[model samples]
Target: MAVITMIEAQKRSGRFNIYVDGHYAFPVSDSVLVDFRLYKGMEIDKELEGRLTAADDVAKAYNRALDYLSHQLRTEKEVQDKLTTLEIPEDTIEQTLKKLRDFSLVDDAHYAASYVRTMMHTGDKGPRVIRQHLRQKGVGEKVIDDALVLFTPAEQLAVGTAVAQKLAKRYQHNSTRNREQKMRQGLMTRGFGGDAIKAMLDAVDLTPDVDEQHALLAKQGEKLWHRYRALSESERQYKTKQALYRKGFKLDDISQWLADFGESVD
Candidate 1:
């Protein structure tokens, strides 16, 4: 048996160091000290000391979890990950998570819904992108699916159109075909499905006028001309024609430009 020789407050708030047999034993939160009614001259056996120590660990783990949650809404897995990184024992982490759930502080469903809303309204993200982000954050599939119910097809089209329109404006200087292609690639990278991308493309007026087409052809053609300047004239024309073809320009347009530039076709 060991006798409590002293109790002293720690420099950190809400914690105290205990002394047993005139030597330092352990530090515990104020709540743990009060719950265990620790005081000087109290006698404790090894088993009781172990129990108090475990209880103090639980209290500390719970407090740390609370502090982590206080800053923002967190998914259960996110909270678990943070506690695990802190090196809290598994059983204590489970207990802390249970308490948090009971108090409605950590709920995956709620977190998923809020996440979807924020991404749609503020981040301008589509459902697929939002779902991918939630999955990466360790939210369950069912929870993610349920949360995505809020993003209806009509709503998705609206958001997709808004995103596509912005990109279209940004690429207004490019040819119609190049601008449309860029817009599609950008939306695909952002996780919009093919159908959604098609819908957005169909809605946008991407047709270039005669002047715009001529300007784009002149700009791109000059670059290609310089690149193939070192090649034989015949090879240069063939390669430049192939290059412009791959860039979504019609063959007729390329032929017309070649003729206007006084380049003879084989």
Candidate 2:
């Protein structure tokens, strides 16, 4: 057994420095002090001292966890990983997590749902992208699935069509096939599924009329013409035809443009 020789308040708020047998022993938050009823001249056994120390550790760990959560909403795993990084003991971390969850401060389901809504409305991300992002954040599969239930097929089509229409307008200079292909690739990259992309492409008007095709040919043809300017006329014609064909122009369109420009494939 040891006698508590002194109990002095520290400069930091709500903390106390305790001494046992005339020597500094440990520091504890006021809550711990009050809970244990520690006072100068009180006698305590080694086992009681050990229990008090453990209790103090839990208080400190809980405080640190609260500080971490003060910035933004975090998933349970994020908080667990952070506490682990701090080297808190596994048992203490579990206790701290229980406390946080009891207070509803660390709900993975709520976090995942909020994240999905924010990404869908503001960031305009698809379900696949949102799923991947939630997975990376350590949200459980079941929670993510439940959260994604809010994104209905109709909603997916609405978002996918808006994105596809934007891409179609941007690439209007390309042939219909080329414009559709680019739109598909762009939607897929943004995390839209194949079915959604197809639906969007089917609904949008990507066909290039004669005037649009002529405009595209003129714009692209001028560059190609300059590129093969040094070649023989026949060779330049062959190269330009091949280049336009690879760029998704039809054979009839290329042939007419070549004839109009006084160039022959032969």
Candidate 3:
């Protein structure tokens, strides 16, 4: 048993240093001091002291969680992980989590839904990538699934078409097929599924005009012609044709370009 000798306020507000028998014992928040009704000359047993400190721990953990959530909405796992990093005891962490949930301050479902809505409005990530990011944040699969329902097929098409159109413009210098292929890859990278990407590709106009196509093919064919210059003429022509074919140029186009290239060289 020990007797309280002093209750002194710490430099930080709302916290106090507890002294027992003329020696510093532990520190607690103002709320804990009030709840436990500690004062100088009050007698306390070790068990009661344990309970007071435990309550203080819960208060600290809960306050820290509130501060963390002040920046943005946080999942329950995020708050739990934050408390764990502070070295809060597991039971204390659990208690803090309960208090937060009781107040509706920390909820995974709310976090996931808000995150998806925010991304849907302002982000380029596809549903799969968004799910991956939410999962990494420790949101549950079911919560993520429910939240992603807000990202409807209609939304996907709208966003994907916009993205695909932008990609087609970026790849406009390539042949029609090559530009379409690049747009497809770009859409996929941005998280659109195959069907969504295909629809978006179909919806966007990637076909270059005849003059643009000819110029693009000629530019690429010239580079290839130079690249294979070291090879025998037959091998060079064969290599150029194969390279242009792989780049989405038709065989007839390749043959005509090669013939025109040879004539121009002569």
- Residue 37, candidate 1: alpha-carbon lDDT: 94
What is residue 16's positional error in candidate 2, in angstroms?
Answer: 2.2
Quote each prediction's TM-score: 0.87, 0.86, 0.90
**lDDT tens string, model 3, 213-236?**
878889999999899989987788
Model 1 / residue 233 / CA error / Å: 2.7
True-vs-predicted CA distance for residue 108, candidate 1, Å: 1.4
Q: What C-alpha RMSD separates each model from the true structure?
A: 2.6, 2.6, 2.6
Local accuracy of candidate 2 as per-residue lDDT tens digits, 124-225:
678998899889889989999999998888878888888988898898878766877898999998888987888988888765687888889877887998
On lDDT, the stronger of 1 and 2 is: 1
Instruction: For residues 2-85, write the lDDT of model 1, one tens digit per residue.
Output: 899999998999999999999998888998899989889999899988988888888888898889989999888899999999
Q: Pick the candidate with the highest lDDT.
A: 1
- Tell me the lDDT of candidate 2: 0.87
lDDT, candidates in the order shown? 0.88, 0.87, 0.87
Give the better candidate number (1 or 3) by TM-score: 3
**After best superposition, candidate 1 residue 129: deviation in angstroms?**
1.8
Candidates 2 and 3 compared: the better one by TM-score is 3
